[model samples]
Target chain A: MKKYKCIVVKSQTYAKKAEKVLSHNGISSSVLHCKAGSVSGCGRCVKVEEKDVDRSVDILKKEGVILTGEIYGL
Target chain B: MDYKKTVYLDNAASSFPKPRSVIERMNRVLNENTANPGRSGHRLSLSASQIVFDARTVVADFFGISGHEENVVFTYNATYAINTVLRGLLRRGDHVIISDIEHNSVLRPLVAMKKDGISFDIAETFESDDLTVSSFSSHIRNNTKMIFVSHASNVSGAILPLKALGDLCKKNGILFCVDASQTAGHLPINIREMNISALCAPGHKSLMGPQGTGVIVISPELNTEISPLVYGGTGTDSLLDIQPYVLPEYLESGTLNTVGIAGLAEGIRFCMNEKNAISSKISSLFSYAYSELEKIPHIRLFSPKTDNVGIISFSVDGIDSEQITRFLDSEGICVRGGFHCSALFHKKALSDRFGLVRVSPGVFNTKKDIFTFIISIKRLKK
Candidate 1:
């Protein structure tokens, strides 16, 4: 099984919300404790498997999360 | 009359209808004396230096710091000031403790620094009323090198227990840094008494100053060796290859926003003279609006009843924050929507989906504005 890494950049205050969104969608993801460099300290990002990247992004966007950027491939 | 309309409720982001004195002073500086401050011994340069020095003095006095103009370093904005401290002070292996309601400006820098081996822990805010200082003590670790938190939240307008936190950090021998972006000019702050080692604030917000001007006040104790994040000609020690080992000149390397600083000086002067009146007016407005909003059963207010500034955050049941903001905008009302740069707080508060509509009233707002806003919100409920 190939594992794809998807970075979920968001506000740290929204970390639990993002986690919940991922879990509800059954997409296993881990919160990546890094700052979104481009936005001058906007929020936190999460990392998930590449296979679940599309679903995860859709879920987050559906939930109105502001995604700064994302990177794939673990 | 044009003055008879247009409600400006976004003061927490930046003030509107800036004092005429602020504009006049800025104009004076630009027209008569616009020179590189502290760069030359010429008369124009000396005059520019005097303007900066006077502004620094006003900032120092306003914040309750003793006369030490050199300790006040100017920056582009509060975010820049916070980044300077977080990057310069914290090193690998350092442990920092922050609060749950911090703005992204504080959170992001620390998050980035975590990659370099710095670890962070957050103190959970009390679920109910009263965010007391004792709540923060439990989160402090033996390895905690710094205790950083905001003086007041930009999102919810909840004032943190800075005095108590300052005492705890002082007793624990930890560096205490405060982000005063939301409360610097509107609320009273005493850096000396609070034991705040470094204080960061945006001059444009409550200070009624123009954008592009911010300040970082460093404690004299830490002034000896705080590294400069950016290094260049500081208009002093021109021959030295290294950054100046002084107070402000060390951190202030590039050309400053002189015009903005001049405006900020006047703004601070106006704030100082009208602090009590301005606070009372803002509080009255918030109190009236909070009471009215509480009556709207579907709306959940995030700011505490007491100890809140002029800002208020609330969510309308089943209505998207953007939609509500747009509706209010259509009524000629201004409000901020979305996560308000505090995504972590939104997650913790369970408001991540729609975020919250933040309405911050300034001194220029009136009773009619609040009444109209309430009517607009109530109409949305129906």
Candidate 2:
């Protein structure tokens, strides 16, 4: 059981690019299975710690990646 | 495998005996993940995708391309990278300017595109910074879209005034593209400082990577959308039939050279770690070789005595270059002969008929290796 929030992306490309931006910002994340009720072309999503959720979303948005949903308490 | 004993001076062609870590990394990638990167979400596929992204990020940081690691597009060689920029960005009726001494990689593509209603002009270098700048500036027109020049001539190892030209391009509002195949890992090139719009380089030469790895560091400011050179699966925008309009994914289509890029990342790491000291040592060795070769008679040296990258091109007066190359081959000294793949430069060097023997020393080459090469040249003069 993971206690982090999720950033659902349409594909692995956006997910990876988001991960790159987040990693450069000193936020650690893991590529885990996408959350339930997520619409994605790819199977994976990035899981970031709950405290860093807002910053992660901001970074992803800055990089032009669209976040479909944010699932909590995974 | 033991290139330490062989006098390998043909680094400009393709580097021999890549770093052990490069080979090991490639082997690991080939064994661990052969899946298509960014296309699938499986663990192995994601791992392969990460290596590709890592190579891009490493290249961007190494070249001082700010914040847009996604703009670093990987290709099979510098030739492909150069062609991508030339063809992708140029439009009909556009005029492109190129330096007089450019590799066939840049020249051939422009020549081929002439059929598409594009034209080009050549800017001659006079060994003076102001004169060279004027040469390029004089050719700029309203339709002039870009300026493409090699950072250093592969045929002569003469460095171009890149920063001055970059400034000129900036003032003129034209995209400045540099073919860095000869100087990428050899010289310190900060794309931001140079105001370069695009920098294309091969991973095999001074970058210490294996063949089949090349990169293009593009500026985010260029108006050119850079239509995809090869379009297939970008892994993003999967439902859309059209190609993605992003930075790397747009240009990078089809399956990437995952194993080669894996090795290339380590190669860039090695270069980064060994930057200033390694460049100094290479320059010292080149100076030694240049001086020693100058002592030989009936030789026409085309490169500068100092201030040159590891490459040096020269010809023995009245002696065919092929004969010298064959003799050197027998001497176990690996150097390239005949044209060195730059006919324009060979013509300017006045050795088109006779060709030129190009000696591109690698960082791994030693003073003893250069001494042996000079002695061999001396023997051939007899």
Candidate 3:
């Protein structure tokens, strides 16, 4: 199991769309139903590697995935 | 002796007892594929994303919204989908035309938009396609930007001449949008042949999906760009301060109900599998219910005499709609009472009162159910 960082969003739809954008671009990530809302407002989040956070977030934003907050996963 | 069994007749509202596949699919997603879609780079996330995409394809194809899957945008509900089209497409000073018997979903949005400088005219629905089309044509003006209508009336079970309206709009270069909340899963709607610009529907109703899921299928030829109603993290364009100007994202904002959508996809699949059987079943039931109800004296059928969807609205002589509904409720029959939430329909339906009892059947219903329902209504007359 690879340690991953999490980017959370309120909308499960956005979360799903964001995952597709990252995958289409060859980014490694997974969606989770964790308490990332403690960091972001949404309960749904996508997990990426900590080192890949900046790259993933940038691409997601550029692709128009609405994000709330990004946090390092435990 | 009256059997103690609950009969559901409010399929016009959120459908009851969603197909087994719908529930199973939803549970599988929640338990196994619980990844936050699209935002992830992991396998689970990607698979989850696939689920959402597949759902879009299912809905898009279901309505004949061809070309791309992204053209089908999901919303919170049909009302939200309608608002996305109304609030997004219509600008200030734009005018709209609609059928007289529209659900509150259309009327309420137009009302809210009125203050913003947009106006609307209501076209009376007629038995003849030419008459209905002319009724809408008579309201067309230089400023008329769109013709919006419910594909089938929730109150009257009246099916609109959507194909005719679509043709009229194409000839005039005006946009045509339909609220298919009542008909999406029940009947076939091909966006291309109909020349419709947008078709909005709820996943919960005819789609046989869960509540809180809806979709707006856009035609590829549509030139006008509609804005989204809600805004937040799209997961793709996280860094952009403005919402993404893309196919689905352009109209969608914030987190969506993925579980609901997963359920909706299965619901649509269930409908597709049983399409012929379901349609014929509804047709048979409608005809039977209509003929049976007509035989009972004092029952006034408000629905048009022509072919209709499963929805049937009527009032009994000297009996309040709610009172009749209550009597039926006590007999283990469930039907909608009151105005069904459309003030305009109510105004046209019962000027003396605010509501009518509506008996809407679903694919799951049996002929016996309608028979029991008729017996309950006959009891009211006695």
Candidate 4:
């Protein structure tokens, strides 16, 4: 079983954007629904392999994608 | 109705015969799936969400929004977008500056907001860029928070100095907004380059998209300041009692017109493919029409000779503009008549007595169409 890390974002818009930017940077990511109580307002997060988490987040942040919460293992 | 026989000169209102891609894309969306975007996590819903996101990207790139694609908020039309910015960003004590030639969309909302303690001043527009900038400068007050103006007059097609106005706003530390009702897609506009804090435009007009589609692109500086005019379920924030503070979803509350937005993306792509050729064609047609229309004895042209957006407003010495429009309609020529929902422009032009006849040429129009329109107008009785 391959574990993944979820990066919570502001909304679905940002999740999708982050997913696109990460893909462009050769890091594959998928958008998933954030579980209850994981985030306060936005309920969407971009999921990536645990190994690719740091690179994916750096790409998203540099591209102006707003990440709402800390990364959590899923 | 023989469609091909009639010439359409009302492109400024709502462009006819949208790009085949727009129609095809819209039909494809309607036929395939009409699922709501940003809702369920199912395949159909995700596809719909992708379609809307793609549109936001295209619109954002087209308007120089750069990386902040979520800043694009879809609405019903330019009026709705303008109202959103006007009502969303403006507070009770904040004053706004608008141009004298603004459409009723901008004027009426500011007037209505007056009762709410918000105030606005009208800046006179002149043919010279210096005089126009000076006029806007003279109207700026200590409380002037935003300067909202149309990129061009919908009636006279007079193009305003957007870059100059943007610079003035930057100097004054005021937020700048544009109502690109007539100039969007027809003219080149970069929100970043123009220092525009917010831009409002209808996708149906120069954008060549289906009706019921419009966009308001906000800069990062003014994003949180603008409150949502309509608030409801935003998919992600449904668990909360109040609306989400996130962008786009924050402003877009109801179900979006997925099909319209799908077509709007194609429409913007069509404009991008056509490039400067579109403006060139409109300018050529306008010049031809102006040269011919001025030849008529009683015709008085109101549009600027140069730097116009392909719109020509004219009137006979003694005949009502609507009467001439009716005559042209009888000749199978289509044009707009009356006040054009611009009371200030009409009042300023002193054509309020009977209004002016307006003909706006689009990229699809030709010199022959202008000649036909000119011939039809020449046949009118004074």
Candidate order, TM-score descending: 4, 2, 3, 1
True contacts kept of each: 0.00, 0.23, 0.05, 0.47
Candidate 2 local Cα displacement, residue B291, angstroms: 0.9
Q: Is 2 or 3 the stronger prediction by lDDT?
A: 2
Q: TM-score per model for chain B alone?
A: 0.96, 0.97, 0.96, 0.98
Off by over 4 Å in 2: A1-13, A23-28, A32-45, A48-53, A63-74, B1-5
After superposition, the stretches of candidate 4 with alpha carbons farther than 4 Å from their true spots are: A40-42
Q: All candidates' lDDT scores?
A: 0.80, 0.83, 0.82, 0.90
B1-382 per-residue lDDT for model 3 (tens digits): 4433778889998788689899999998888877776565567776766788889868877878633576789888999999989999999999999888898889998998899999999988787879999999999999999999999988888888889899999999999999998999887899999998999999999899998899999997898999888877666545457776666866766656778889998999999999999999988888899999989887788887676878888888777888888899888988998888788777865533736889888988899999999888887787
| DockQ per candidate | 0.01, 0.35, 0.08, 0.56
Candidates in descending lDDT order: 4, 2, 3, 1
Q: Write the per-residue lDDT of candidate 2 for residues A1-74, one digit (tens) a residue.
A: 43687777645556777787898899999776564345433345788998888888888888766566655557
Q: Once superposed on the true structure, which residue ranges of model 3 sit more than 4 Å away at CA? A: A1-74, B1-4, B351-354
What DockQ score does model 2 reach against the true complex?
Answer: 0.35
Q: In model 1, what lDDT does residue B42 have?
A: 54
Considering lDDT, which of the candidate structures 1 and 3 is the better prediction for this target?
3
Query: What TM-score against the true chain A does chain A of each candidate get?
Result: 0.71, 0.79, 0.81, 0.91
TM-score of 2: 0.93
Model 1 earns a TM-score of 0.81
For model 2, residues B222-289, the per-residue Cα lDDT tens digits are 66788767888876655567775666878888888999998888998889988986788788878888
CA shift of B325, model 2, Å: 0.3
Give lDDT tens digits, candidate 4, residues B1-382: 8898999999989998688899999999999989988887777887898899999999989998866778999999999999999999899899999999999999999999999999999999999999999999999999999999999999999999999999999999999999999999988999988999999999999999999999999976664478989989888866679787878888898899999999989999999999789978988899899898888887899999998988999989988889888999999888999999999999999999989999998888888888888877776753
Backbone-clash count (model 4): 0
lDDT of 1 by residue, B1-382 (tens): 3634667788888888899899999888889988876555456765676688778878888888755566688998999999988887887788999988999998998888878999998887763434556667777787888989998888889888888889999999899999999998888888888899999999999988999999998886664356778988676435456664555767888887889999998999999999889999999999999999999988999888888877889998888999999888877888899998997789888999988999999887889999999999988888
Query: Which scores higher on TM-score, 1 or 3?
Result: 3
Compare the candidates by DockQ and give the number of the best one. 4
